[model samples]
Target: MISELVMVPTDEAVLTGDLVVPGHVPAVVLFAHGSGSSRLSVRNRAAAAELHKAGLGTLLLDLLSEREEREDAATARHRFDIPLLSRRLVAALEWLAQEPNTRDLPAGLFGASTGAAAALMAAAERPERVYAVVSRGGRPDLAGDAIERVAAPVLLIVGGSDEAVLGLNREAAERLSAPHEIHVVPGATHLFPEPGALEEVAEVAGRWFLAHLKERRGPGGRRA
Candidate 1:
């Protein structure tokens, strides 16, 4: 596997990220970390490792800059700004499309918490670019009408013990227009901190992305 530190330009800021690509990768998964998290998130990194082992490329991006994150940490202002976050995610996707290494690969998204809303919104906006989406303990209901516009297949994975979020995922699933499913991880909480719970999340997510991303690929292994 090859790992590179990349700076992705957006309208307002140049976000930093780690792009990891394994040999013979067919697809790339962009991770949208939840509120109060960055590319250094342990869970997201763990999941990315699993995806890499599955022969997929991964981008773990810090959606917010250091200054912006500090500001949000102080005021909690930008964390829930779905439109802003979506724009940044879309910018990253555009950048990826232009990069030689990942330009031809189908793209998928892995979102957690509020980042799921941004991921969904980005998917809705770029239906031709994104092929699949997986949300781990996500708040998809926060996506509102944008959820209905997403064409890519979505898999919402929530912890069974996290009743409130599970309910939210169920409600969002009802509003989805594309193929979608809600998978509840038993004995796990909002963070899936229980032993083996996070592994389950990673396994399910890897399978979902591998299947859907490959299915969405165009001729000669390019993104359709």
Candidate 2:
């Protein structure tokens, strides 16, 4: 696997990112990090590293501006700014779609917290481009009415100890029309705080991406 720190040239300054290209490149994962966290989030970076080893590429980008992060941290709305963050995720997706390394390849999303909502919103906005989504202890309710508009499969991974959040993910899962599943990590906290729990997340995520990110033709798995 080859990893590099890069930038996605966008209208809103340059979106900083980490690119990890695996040997086979079965799919590309666009990550949306949780609140107050940057692309350097250790948990997400760990998952991305495993995905890379499993022949999957990943682009982890900052979902908020430095100024926005500071303000949002002060008000705690930066992580909850569903609309603004979702739009940014969509822009990053479109930008990735135009990149030579990821263009024409199946794409997946790995989102945590409100970032999950942003990922879901982007999937709804660009159904044809996103093949799958994986949410880790995310607040999918922030996606609002976009849930039904999403055409790809979604996997919601919640921590068992995070009972309240798990319930929310269950409700969100019910509203998703596409193929979906909810997996609970027993004894883990909201952030999968338990030891070795994040490793489980990485394995589950690898399987999901491998299963769905393959060449899906159409409704009947036909090549359009």
Candidate 3:
């Protein structure tokens, strides 16, 4: 595997990330962390490790710059700014397309909490480039109208005990015209802190990304 720290330049800011590409992988999953989170989120890193074992690359980045994170932390301003987050994700997608090491592989998005909304918005804005998306305990409903425009297959994974978020996912699923599925981890909570819950998430997500991103196809074997 090739692992490196990289900087992704956006129109507004330069974001930092860790890029890990396992040899001969079919796709890379870009991680969008939720509010108050960053590239170093433990759960996301753990999930990325699982993806590596499955022959997939991963890009985990801080959507906000250091200054922005600090400011947001103080004022609680930027974390819920979905449009800003989406723009950052879209910028990262563009960067991936031009980056020498990752240009040949298809791309996927793995988002948690509010990051899922940003992922969906980015998928809508760059339909041809993003092959698939997976949401872990996400609030995809916050994508607003962009939720209806996303063309890639999506997998929405929610904890069985996270009732409010699960209901939101189901409601969002209705607005999505693209192929999607809701997978509930039995007896798990928002962060999947249960004994085996997170492992189940990583396994299911790995399978979903492999299925859709490997072939750039939707459900029923149709090209996306």
Best by TM-score: 1
Off by over 4 Å in 1: 218-224
lDDT tens readout by residue for model 3, 26-120: 78899999999999999999999999999999999999999999999999899899999999999999899999888877899999999999999
By the lDDT metric, which is better: model 2 or model 3? Answer: 3
Instruction: Name the candidate that leads on lDDT.
Output: 3
Model 2, 1-224: lDDT tens digits are: 65778777656656778887776575799999988898999999899888887888999998777777788779987688788788888888888788777776778999999899999999999898898999999999889999989988999999999999999999998899999999899899998868989999999999998888654655664434
Clashes of each: 0, 1, 0
Segments in model 2 whose C-alpha atoms lie over 4 Å from true places = 215-224
- TM-score winner between 2 and 3, please give it: 3
The C-alpha TM-scores of every prediction are 0.97, 0.92, 0.96
Candidate 1 lDDT tens digits, 1-69:
679999999999999999999987888999999999999999999999999888899999999999999
Native RMSD of candidate 1 (Å): 1.1
In order, what lDDT does every prediction score?
0.94, 0.86, 0.94
TM-score (C-alpha) between model 3 and the true structure = 0.96
Candidate 3 local lDDT, residue 81: 97
Model 3 stretches astray by more than 4 angstroms: 217-224
Q: Candidate 1, 194: how far from true, in Å?
A: 0.2
